[model samples]
Target chain A: MATVELTFSALPAHVRTARLVATAIARRTGVEESLLDEVRLAVGEACSRAVEAHRLHCPGEPIRIELRDDLGRFEVTVTDSAPSDELEQERELLRFDDPLGQLPDTLMTGFGIAVIVGLADDVQVYPSQKGMRIRMSWPAATNGLSPV
Target chain B: MDLKLDHHSEDRLTIVEVEGEIDVYTAPRLRELLIDLVNKGNFHLLVNMEKVDFLDSTGLGVLVGGLKRVRAHDGSLELVCTQERILKIFRITGLTKVFGIYASVEEAKEAHGRDK
Candidate 1:
């Protein structure tokens, strides 16, 4: 497994940094230009969501992002330090609240996960030992699978 | 990520040229500018996203908010985007039906003018 890891402060500023690092890794590995934009946007949404989660729950923990290129497929995981159930609560909130979908313009929440789900070829959310892990994968070749 | 926002007037339309990444940190900056512009009675807004290389959900929220703000004043908020990456977000969110998106600033201006 060819892997790259980045751990950064759970700050808004670091979200862009995470995206840039992921873009650099993807480019260096010769990921297609068309897919590079998706990869970058997915990485940003994941990191930004983690940062927001940490701000509300963990407060001071750093976000951990791991990228693994397994053959022609690439996997990126963003780990948050909040409790495992915190993500469940968030998922429920997203379902009920309609953060970006139906909310009034005054509400500025809910677009992160939607964009992540839209861009990532595959998305898996699971509870880790410390908190929760959001794993997103992108295949080098086009897969007909849509975001779930 | 540096965001450069340039404002200009063309054919009585307000055009904002946005360059760089619009994410969590920088979105608020754009939001403030848009809100200020709308509040100042400068509506019929056209945001040119040609140079914006990256945009996240936060940026989308800001745009939606700007749209609503302008609509409240009976004005319009349009987007000038030629990049598929940025357009994908709008399409995924079904915002294409909500905002008028054009290929160029001139097209956006003309479309808004036609509406008036």
Candidate 2:
């Protein structure tokens, strides 16, 4: 099992760095070449979401990303330390989300969560008391498709 | 990485060539460029995404905004992209139907034949 951790200030600039690092680890972990774009897009969406949350709610907080490869399975978890009072609302949306990947209205436009759910093989979002964590996984190639 | 933007007038419309990744960090620049073009009376806009290596939801949002900006002026905003990787993002976002995506700049211009 190999794991890589990245921590950066909740700035939008760091989102690209997170995506690049995640893609590198995923490629080295035996993920298929065709799905690399998915890996990159999912990581970018998750990180961008976290950065937006932090900028709006908790300035100066740091975002954390973890990339793990185990048994030919690649997984990424992005955490944002931005507090939100709308935890229940978020939970409700995740549960009964209007058609996965369906974008929000222009005024309420936030496409990260929707896009992440669309691209990731498996996704789980946990809203903590002070922050939120999004875990997304993609199955590795030549691994007989062990669910991540 | 950062983004690069360049545009030129070709007979009837303006085509903006975009290069590099478009994310939350870089989407604002694209948005600014689009807004500037629209503000300068260059309403009919065609963005060439052939060199765009990465695009996220933020970038898509910028494109959508640009489209809206042009629509307000009765102008059109289209795209030119051949990369399947980039096109997949459009499909994922349901933007494939929203933007008249073409395989090349020539094809996109031809689509605007009525302008000629």
Candidate 3:
């Protein structure tokens, strides 16, 4: 098993660093290059959301990212001190359907989470005293996962 | 992330080269650039995504937003998508039919040629 932990100051540069770490870990785990890109993109998006949440609700807080790989499976978790209601609202906003609406201009940017859920095998959300935790997993098989 | 902005024949064609992942975080930068270009009266756009590695819905939204803004002025937005992952995203989002997607920047230039 391999693990990497990083903490950032909820700043934009840290967000990019988190993505680079996830990409490197995904490549080290022998994940398909394309799948690795997808994983990295998901991690980046989730972390960005957390950073945005922290900036809005808990300024000056730190963002934590934990990535683990155990041969056939990979897990990425992003944590920050923010309200669960925001995450729930994000999830809800993404679930709405609007073929022609201005999704980008709105707060529906959480659509990245949906893409992550679609590409990964498992997605779990936990609200702790520390903050909201978002865990996403991908299996080696890469089969039977639902599309976003 | 590296963004290259070029203006060809004032108010006619503008090409933007984006090399990086276009997600929620990085998309704002692209949005600002594209919107600023449009606001400056440069409507026609050809986004060269040959070097772009990844794009999500936010990225898609940026493209869509640019398309709408350009079309509002009777202009058009074209794309040069060579990367497999980026192509897959366009195919999955049904945006392949929405934008004038070409195999290379050359083709995109050629298509814009006819438009001009």
Best model per lDDT: 2
Residues A1-148, model 3: lDDT tens digits: 6678998887765777888888777666666666777787678767877777787778788989998876577788888897766557655655234434545534334455555665666888786556788898776423321232
Clashes of each: 0, 0, 0
Candidates' TM-scores?
0.85, 0.87, 0.78
Chain B TM-score of all predictions, in order?
A: 0.95, 0.96, 0.89
Candidate 1 local lDDT, residue A129: 49
Model 1 stretches with alpha carbons more than 4 Å out: A83-109, A127-130, A140-148
For all predictions in the order shown, the interface RMSD in Å is 3.6, 4.9, 3.2
The C-alpha stretches of model 3 lying farther than 4 A from their native spots are: A90-100, A103-108, A126-131, A140-148, B9-11, B21-26, B56-58, B91-94, B109-116
Q: Model 1 clash pairs?
A: none
| Local accuracy of candidate 2 as per-residue lDDT tens digits, A5-81 | 99999888888888888988888777888888899999998888788788878878889999988665798999888
CA-lDDT, candidates in order: 0.79, 0.81, 0.72
Best by TM-score: 2
- Per-residue lDDT tens digits of candidate 1, residues A86-146? 4554455553233324453223334666677888989987765477788998775333212
**What DockQ does every candidate get?**
0.45, 0.38, 0.35
Candidate 2 pairs with clashing backbones: none
What would the TM-score be for candidate 2 when compared with the true structure?
0.87
